[model samples]
Target: MKKPLDSEVFSSMLDASISYWRQQGKKGVWIKLPLELSNLVEAATKAGFRYHHAEPDYLMLVRWIPNNTPDVLPANASHRVSIGAFVMNSKREVLVVQEKYGRFSGIGLWKLPTGAVDEGEDICTAATREVKEETGIDTDFVEVLAFRQGHKSFFQKSDLFFICMLQPRSFDIQKQASEIEAAQWMPIDEYAAQPLVGGNELVNLITKVCLARFGGTYNGFSPQLTTSASGKQTFLYFNGHFP
Candidate 1:
């Protein structure tokens, strides 16, 4: 009789085989190895599979499981009043506001004209109100594109992002003394080059989302984590950190 393969060796071989098969676009390959393959069994378990015993070898079985459906946002959700906006102009430049107060101060970075969604107001209504209050621009039609939440943060609040198309209106850009320092419309390239208050990961996610909508590029959104100087870690898009 042949000696059984070592568990460690079996695991390594299994991993390598899986990688090769994945690269080749092959699906659902199983391995029958020895019962002494403890490491292989553990790895298969971690990969959402179960192991069974066969006559001379252990049977490694894999099953495809669909991801659980995400929970639906409450119709009357009153978590927090955070908001983000995507304001585009006739010149193809997007309007991003600099946060004057809070943790993102003096960053010279760009962000959507957003603020808290007031109590007793719908997200769309709150978005319109925030834009008007922040940038002095009144937007009539508000459309929500995506919703985001952070894992954890300093502020301990949820951020709601809306993709809104503005109506034809004329107004002067003014900064609210209490909240914003400066406001401007910058081209996509210029905005992309500027540093982001939320960090590089956030900027990348926002860029991908915007490009997919307006620039015909469709890379999906990637979440980010930002750790502040004060040792407070906040999940970007899920919450805001205020200094």
Candidate 2:
């Protein structure tokens, strides 16, 4: 809808539209106002519209018309998903990288190849992709070893980090020059003994879990192909190895 020069006109039109929608049994109403039309926000609230979300350039307002039912609108995205690859070779060497940035930078801490999952990308695929991008090592996704959830980590948003097990298909390390300071195959024992890994409780536990998987004493969540209710094929991750 176009922004009106007069707030009184916008209010009248909004009221009329709401009444018409209610008469037609419409349950939900959304109004998006551009920054230039912010003057209409007060008019919208006066008409019972509440804030749904906002961006730098716009504001979204919502209202529910049905008195018998409750509002069921979903909120904006609350969590950012990331993936870390734990790749161990037959010789007990793990693929590790030292990032040029982030908390572990300049500390000489060799950590797993990790990156944020892209939109519409599977977690398993993300793990392999991060490994390939950071180290130039080809790998096959195995299973998710574990996951860590932390609040207010990035931009005041919650974080979900999935630790995935990957099998190496190539051994050469060509570290990403832009982001990685170094990448190599470090021995599992040495990787686990890192001061940074041992200092952080969650990282230490994750390292142990990776070791357990390597020792064949622990099984991680594996993905199985399945069809969703919408007739879309997707992967459902779980301990499907169990009987």
Number of the top candidate by lDDT? 2
Give the alpha carbon lDDT tens digit for every residue of 46-162 in model 2. 999999888889999999988899888777689999999999898999999998988889989999999999889999888988999999999988999899899998888899999
For 3-105, candidate 1 gives per-residue lDDT tens digits of 5666566567666766776677655544554556444666666655554334455554553333354423222222464667776766777777888888677
Q: What is the C-alpha lDDT of each candidate?
A: 0.59, 0.90
| Candidate 1 residue spans exceeding 4 A from truth | 1-78, 154-168, 197-199, 216-243
Question: Clashing pairs in model 1?
Answer: 81-117, 103-243, 149-238, 150-238, 153-234
Residue 42 of model 1 has an lDDT of 65
Query: Candidate 2: minimum summed lDDT over ten consecutive residues — where?
Result: 1-10
Q: How does candidate 2 score on lDDT?
A: 0.90
